[model samples]
Target: MEGKSWIFKNRPAIVASGVVGGPFEQKSPYSGEFDLVKDTLWMEEESFEKANRQLIESAIQVTLDKKTLSSNDIDALLMGDLINQITPTSMAARTLSAPYLGLFSACATSMEGLALSAALIDGGYCQKVLTGASSHNAAVEKQFRYPTEYGGQKPPTAQWTVTGAGVALIEKASPHNAPLALIEKATIGKVVDNGIKDPFNMGAAMAPAAADVIERHLNQTNQTIDDFDLIITGDLSRIGHPITEDLLKQKGIAFKSGQFLDCGKMFYPELPDVQAGASGPACSAMLVYSHFLNELQKGSVRKILSVATGALLSPLTFQQGESIPCIAHAVELSSPAVNSQSFRGEE
Candidate 1:
């Protein structure tokens, strides 16, 4: 059977899940699990280094429980984050028992991790793989813009960096496992730098990159806009979302507004007081791990193509008057069958 056929046949299941350290959980209006804020974990300080370590440990514990395997069972660990040279990920991986491979795609790091882990399992390079991403609001703010206490009012196109992390365990196919929807295809983004220089205007910087990847993904997969149940963009906020739709439509691909969603928008509707939308690796990661993952498990939605978008610009580059280079990574997820067995177990 062909690679795609094998993917569609032996669906991979996300047997376990975990999230560590975030400031969102402690903040106002987001304090309860039933409440959107409660559903997310958050950290208080600007310590991404600390948050990254917690995230990896939490994910490893969850994976161990779900797969009935230990850290030694994992053949490899793949991770990424929005920190410098992905320092948070690399440093966190040092403590893990599994071998590690660092990756980066800005906000798209988590989906990138998933895609790579799926490939490793499908290619028989590994049996069990762990993948995840983390980001802290304080660290990102200080690194990309001003400090959290800078007290600057942001423009409508600006986004709030989320202080959180999410991790998932991808394992080999087994008769006792539920079909954890496999990654049918991935559309790795090419760097799209159109010379948009404003650091505050990330929507303008990233819109084209999102459009480019979406187009390329559809073209490569031979799938139309209607092929998947949902087409989710990472952090395109209100500004970039419309532009992405326009660009895709210009390419003759039409996706319904209901079918199209943004993780930024989902993160906090009440925080509309927030400008461009929610951002940072954790913004999208939390939404996917908590909201979308649950929907998939309950069979509310079947197939989804999630694209995590990022603006590859730093405070230094922007200060140096360089344009923002943008990229996105796309991952596909599907619902497991009703008769499948759950992988939930004690750690």
Candidate 2:
């Protein structure tokens, strides 16, 4: 039953989350937010690929350790990464030897995993699910653009691919303990292409897609911008963030600036050389799990509409002059105390 969204009747609980960041992220103002910060992006691995595996696997371990449960206790592991064929995520899964599902929606993989994780539990497929995403800046640069060894000059519109990984454990909501937040609903996004061929200008390319999903979610749920405490957008960076607001305004759905924020812009906004800001699956995943979840725990926020956006483009596609198609997935997390009307009142 898809309304404006998929409302999980079981209300999957975010039992625990773990985040890890690279050296640049550790020095940023948001440094202290994550569970672990590596001094080197390489993490003592022979290659960036191996390092990415370490980052993601370590994050899952951190969350599992918090629950005193190993991979053996997990019903399934849903993971994704930016690499081609999602190699790092696959390697991490192999180490754990848990049932695995590989996913990719560019940078939107984090929320995609979370949304599916909720569905798995809500559908009685499992009692618990582990979901998350990872990305390595050096590795992505090699795949989509000039390698780090090239020292290529980047334009202001280019976003820095974040070197990080974030993981989360979600289970059925229970009375034994208050969850970090409840997964109430998710709005799947459609592919939106506006003939944008420049990979550097992803922010502009992705804004329309984010606006579309947000609008559909609000209209479908019979709710307004007034409902969520925060409307979080994934990886729209500085340039795309305002475009999203403008597009929404054109749709006659205006959102307050204070209430709307983007994970890409928030992650490393003021940092020099970060270009447009951070973009990667880990950008929104880390900011949401490591930072915003803490705020939810402290009673600073009761609910959030997290929309993770992704620009669907490959090196070959760009070379072939195809426009970048984009997508956005929104996940609504509400505190049990102020569950409010953000959820479906009748089912």
Candidate 3:
């Protein structure tokens, strides 16, 4: 790894992915891409948190079923969620037979898991890894803010938590399995805080971190925005999307028209009551693993840079009057059709 970035020479491949969403997500324009859609958020479970865990389990099971593999075939499991201590993800991992590693980066946990999965395979330490992130609307809201029954008024900056889970099976590159996308590079982010204390304004809190990592990733890799067919941010939503664009512009970095977008903003463009749009760990995960992966497979986009951002503020921290610290993790992905000439690193 060189300066917070890892250029994978072997190019780990995301062979298969699974996305499970709640009934609310059924209205999303990309709902057709989901592997499974539960008719209710309860998911036949007793509590919302249990339902949250079920989402992760269902997503992982779907991914395994797609490849006709089982837990015995998985080398490791890296998963996370937005619940306190990420209990939902840990509880779900308990049911899995493979070695498990729980991760947390607020909304950015998805890319964090993917980056580590690619690193493990690229370093020849593991053959196959299950990595994912999940978020539940009710469970996260109850923990992070007021309960759904509170009837509290929210500002337009507030983003709705996505009720979904996205899991992927990443493995060593191979000739037999034509993977969806290849992981070429990953740029880990540094924490950035601008003294933003309102949890409802997560987009504003995370925007700077996203821009910082993007600039660093391009500089360290000697690449430009033109190198990628698309550059997508995790859950910046409508508010942070423009802020990020302006920040990049001030830094003298410009993107081609239609070259940049935010998964949060696009996740539920038409859904009502989604004030700023979607914001959660699953926001980016669901979009990338489902719609964007299909785009790569269909050759619609040859290369993509995904930057997943996170606002690292707990309820306790907020209650104690601490500012929200934010981070963003970037992963470079390309269609398998792209040749080795596009990959960088010491081979």
Candidate 4:
């Protein structure tokens, strides 16, 4: 059977209740302005399970406040995170009263959840879906990169894992609710391995996968880079972003210099000094919640295509001589001009 379309032509109604959590008071390798490298609010636990629980609880609180929703009111909770067996997300869901669905797309998990929830609402599956993703700096480091205490010097292209979470409530399109943005079109990525095997060099490993999706998205939608105000790449970092662009140019596609931005670059630009860029699930989530969502609300930018990229590889698999498998999911965001009228009346 053909895959279902994740993009919405009529534009779905979604509100990012806002994000909660940061690398505060956590025992981590980073310090200073970029000290919050843990990318999460929970640092009280040494075990991944405990940290995951804390992260989920924080996300749930944010969702409740933003939507004015109680745990019993939500139809379903769709969540994911980067961890073995997705333990963090699973544990967090156990505390919630809403039915839960777990997903795994590495870094792209947030976008994937948003896309699927939008599709479900669009198909009349239900209304009021909550989707979120989180990442812990310590756990990710221990699993993928070196130990948090290793203190090894990173390459220029390496991206710091953000310790953060983002939650968005997706509802049926309506005339009243804020029309945050819709998934206009999406080009799902196939697993691509170019034989680059360094776990630390994720940018290089995932660049080809990013290039493939960019090519296919433009081709399938018949939209060029200029069609949208911005073409944002999730967590590819500085190094992978350029590599993806260079490869795209070779394929006869070109994006304006300022037109392209990386979520990794937007976070921790002053600290961590990531030569290449930022990586991790929180990298993209924080960028979307903190930067893009704010811009859409303020009418700074009307249309945007945010693509979250992921390197779908485990340390065990990489150690077993497996090449990196990467994927990306694209979501479009637009301003809610129609809903703003309601706010005007209240003012």
| lDDT (C-alpha, whole model) for all candidates | 0.71, 0.88, 0.91, 0.72
Full candidate order by TM-score, most accurate first: 3, 2, 4, 1
Error of 2 at 157 (Å): 0.5
Q: Which scores greater on TM-score, model 3 or model 4?
A: 3
Give candidate 4's whole-model lDDT. Answer: 0.72
Model 4 spans with C-alpha error above 4 angstroms? 1-5, 24-42, 46-48, 272-275, 338-347
User: Where is model 3 more than 4 Å wrong at Cα?
Assistant: 340-347
Question: Across residues 1-347, which tens digit of lDDT does each residue of candidate 3 receive?
Answer: 54757988888889999999999999899999999999998999999999999999999999999999988999999989999888888888888878999999999999999999999998988988999999999998888888899978899999999999999999877766678899989999999998999998999989999999999999999999989999999999988888999999999889889999899999999876999999999999999999999998777889999999999999999999999999999999998765544233334
lDDT of 1 by residue, 163-188 (tens): 66677777655555554454556767
Which candidate leads in TM-score? 3
| Residue 327 displacement (Å), model 3 | 0.4
Predicted model with the maximum lDDT: 3
Error of 3 at 311 (Å): 0.4
Q: What TM-score would every model get versus the actual structure?
A: 0.86, 0.96, 0.97, 0.87
Question: What does candidate 4's lDDT look like per residue over 1-347, in tens digits?
Answer: 33333556545556654465455413222222121234543456767557756766776677677667787877888889998888888887878768899999899888888777877776677678888788877678777777778987886767777666777788765655665654455566677788887877888788888788777777777678887778888887767888888999999988886888878766656655556666777677766755677667667777777788888999889879988888888776776652343233221
